[model samples]
Target: MPKDALISTQSRHRMTTRIWHWSNALCLLILLMSGLTIFNAHPRLYWGEYGANDDHAWMAVGSSQTMGYLRLGELRIETTGALGNWQDSQGRTQTWAFPGWATIPSHYSLADGRRWHFFFAWIFSVGLALFMVMSLWNRHIQRDLHMRRDQWRPSHIWRSFRAHLDLRVIRQTAGEDYNSIQKMSYIGVIFLLLPLMIFSGLAMSPAMDANWPFLTDLFGGRQSARSLHFIGAFLLLLFFLVHMVMVLLSGPFRQTRSMITGGEGKEPLA
Candidate 1:
């Protein structure tokens, strides 16, 4: 008999957890790709453009409002002449000019973008909720990600931080299960990114606004919710990028295969 066979080996994963994990991953990828395509219509951020400003800035689909970012609604309008003058929120008139050689704002179907986003959003939400429920029911959240109070101490955090900064961590645990660094990252995505994305997205919709008036206050305002949505998207994208790198470094095939097959022949422990 193999010597390792003498040691007790507990199952590392469950079918439900494995399914949820891969489902979430797939949905997130779809959402991210579609989101990028939508944002490419107006990839900019702006401040103090919405509401009674000076108190808050605004972020929309584009990088900045000054960029004359194209919107789906105006996608059908073809411009024949120089960009005209537009008014800023402060009641100031400004000329919307673009270099002759530069790309001009192209009109697109706002309805189409909105439809795709809203539809995919439902799948994303379902995946998120299912993942959360399973994680909570199985206590996997606590089991896999939550740090005990002792581990939350300054020394532990500092150790993880130093390992991260020194690049030693990447060398030590490239794949396998999540380390402390990964636990923190996963926690952020599960609690912070998922909730923020859902709530902010809902807050922007009129139907949700009518049902949950306080949501606007929670996020400041509708436009504020829109801003939060964009910010949340950026954070999710960041997580996705890091996650892909970890998978690649740790051995994508095995990691992905394990997720799909629930770890070779490992069975549920309980």
Candidate 2:
């Protein structure tokens, strides 16, 4: 066999990370779609413990006789034919928070949506817990994902940021791992954003609230928890978009093959 072939075939992603990565991807897709479907059941958001059509909403999506509007506090903007209100294929008027295309089943079904969301939520949560334990045990977190002391410096961060803006990715050599921005983004998503997502989700659940009232106190109220959950979902979506863009920019085939087959293309050792 050629030397380059031997080097290129070496593993880049660990078996565990690869499995978790794909599993998490599936779960996230299901959860996001179903969650949006569920969101359509309540298109309004409030700040306090109680809110409904009778009470003033901080944010709401609805339609009047003539046009659809999205109201944010005192401000309102027309959102006809997209959000708030639109006509379906049957030529019937419909009002929903998110468009049908953005949701699971592409039609309204609160019960089905909740079931999908909860089922995937459990899988996602359990998978995350197991991944965290395995990562810690294998020292993968410490060894590969950790930011070096030098990377914490403003100069290093600025340099990395500049490199990213210039579309100059620092490719990983045989022994090296992720670049500074990659490490930071991974840390933020895995350690910070995900935990917040899970906690806020639990806080919004009535069953969980009954079992652990402290969750409600921690997040202020159920409405607040719901708001936070929406925010977390948005952040996760943003992360996923950026991640896909990076993979394409960095070499889609190479990056995807690494995740699928756990191999990296040959690179000179640093």
Candidate 3:
């Protein structure tokens, strides 16, 4: 085997990371779809301890007989034929906040949606926990993600940001080395957004409220926790959109192959 090829096979993603990456991806996707279905049950968000039809909500999606609209605070947007109301594959008009295609079961079933979301949520949580421990144990986080002292400089940071904006690949010592922006994005998603999604989800549960009242109180209230969970999920979706664009620009085949084989195309390193 060629020396460079050998290095490439051994140095990019670990077997554990690759496994977690795909499983976590699957988990998040289901959680998002089912969570959207659950959200359709109450397409409104509030900030206080409790929320209901009569209360003022920070955001809402509702449809009238002929039209659909999304209201955020005082501003209202007519979302007709898309959100608040949309047609399913069968051409039946749906009054749900999100259309059937975007949700699990592709129909209005809060109970089923909750089941799907919660089942995947557990898988997602366990995957994250294991990934965290493995990354640290393998020094993947420190070796690949942590910024050197020089990378902390404003000039390097600015350059990295611009290069990312231009969709330019910054090949450092090796092809697998992530730029500072990549590191930060990964860190934010891993340590902040994903965990927030999990905890806020727990905070909304009646069992958590009963067993650990402080968890609910930590987020101010149930309504606030729900709002935060929605926001976190949105941010995650945005992160994935940008991540896919970056991958496409950087060569999806090579990047995806690395994740798939994890550098051991024939015999994986033990």
CA deviation > 4 Å runs, candidate 3: 1-9, 167-174, 264-270
The RMSD of every model to the true structure, in order and in angstroms, is 9.5, 4.1, 4.0
lDDT by residue for model 3 (1-270), tens: 544345335647778889999999999899999999999999999996899999999999989767899999999999999998787788877789998888997889999999999899889999999999988887778767787788888899898888876644432222556777788899899999999999999999999999999999999999999999999999999999988888777777877887887743423222
lDDT of 1 at 228: 74
lDDT, candidate 1, equals 0.60
Best by lDDT: 3
Candidate 2 per-residue C-alpha lDDT over 41-150 given as tens digits, one digit per residue, 9 for 90 to 100: 98887776666789778888887545788888899889998886777768777787777778886888999999999999999999999999988876668767899999
> How big is the positional error of residue 138 in model 3, measured in Å on the Cα after superposition?
0.7
> Could you tell me which 10 consecutive residues in candidate 1 have the lowest summed lDDT?
98-107
Predicted model with the maximum TM-score: 3
Instruction: Rate residue 7 of model 2 by lDDT.
Output: 43
**Candidates' lDDT values, in order?**
0.60, 0.82, 0.85
lDDT of 1 by residue, 1-270 (tens): 333222113335567777767777766655555555455454433432245323322332222234343333334222223232334345544333322222211223345546666676788788778878877876777666776676677788778767655455665554434456677888988888888988988887788888998986688877677667777877887888877876676668777776776555432222
Candidate 2 differs from the real structure by a C-alpha RMSD in angstroms, to one decimal, of 4.1
